[model samples]
Target: MIYVEGGSFDMGYQRGRDGADNDDVKNAKPLHKVTLHSFYIGKFQVTQEQYYAVMDKDSNSHFKGDRLPVETISWEEAKVFIERINQKTGKKFRLPTEAE
Candidate 1:
């Protein structure tokens, strides 16, 4: 895990050298400020082997590898995994909120 010391940052978008043709940039209009608290985040994506160890089920990813990031998981399944992980490790784990 990496400890990220949080601070205020300007979110949304302002006109840039690269014109506003990108819909993603245009949607982030009317720039706003956002503040966050320090938090820990994984340095790497969770892998298939780790998922299986916690959930007792193989990941459904087509690309098979112990080290590969687990995929084909629905939002609900992810929640279940977090719950199981917390139970086993005695540490709370959760999906990051949008602003995180």
Candidate 2:
């Protein structure tokens, strides 16, 4: 997820509305503006091999491919991966904030 610093742009959906949900009518309405900061992200994803190399265990990740992302990981698992990557890379690679 390599996130480039964001620049201003208009975003829109390709499809038209069917019916708006209540939340959409209330808090989600108006489809307003947003602004955010620049950051880096994983271009593809953290692959199973990349994860297993650091974590040293792959039995839990049943996807069984070097190229595929290891799924079924809980939040704790995600944090461990973040910590390992940060430790190995010496850069604070982390999960993106919801705001981003």
Candidate 3:
């Protein structure tokens, strides 16, 4: 895990036609500011072996490799995995929000 010293910053783009063609980018208008609190996040994505160590099951990634990042898991499944891991390790862990 890596410690992130959080702070505030402006988020989103200005509301105007300035070559942002994508709907997603256009919608990111009305620029806003956001603040975040310091937190810890994994330095690397969870690998197949790491997931298996905690969940006691194969991730079933198409390209199977113990060192590869686990894939094909739903949000709920990830939450359950985190819950189980926290129980086993006695540490609080959660997925980062969109802003984070």
Give the winner by TM-score. Answer: 3
Q: Model 1, 14-36: lDDT tens per residue?
A: 67744665876766656689899
Q: What's model 3's TM-score?
A: 0.85
TM-score of model 1 vs. true structure: 0.81
Across 1-100, the per-residue lDDT of candidate 2 in tens digits comes to: 5558875543332225525455444444343456777878777877888888988888276777888888878888889988997899898877876556
lDDT per residue (tens digit) for residues 1-100 in model 3: 8999999988777745445567878567466899999998999999999999999999888889999998888899899999999999998998999889
> Of the candidates numbered 2 and 3, which has the greater lDDT value?
3
Worst 10 residues of 3 by lDDT: 13-22
Q: Report lDDT (CA) for all predictions.
A: 0.87, 0.71, 0.87
- TM-score-better candidate, 1 vs 2: 1
Badly placed stretches (over 4 Å) of model 3 are 26-29
Alpha carbon lDDT at 55, candidate 1? 93
Off by over 4 Å in 2: 1-3, 7-18, 22-32
Clashing pairs in model 1, backbone N/Cα/C closer than 3 A: none
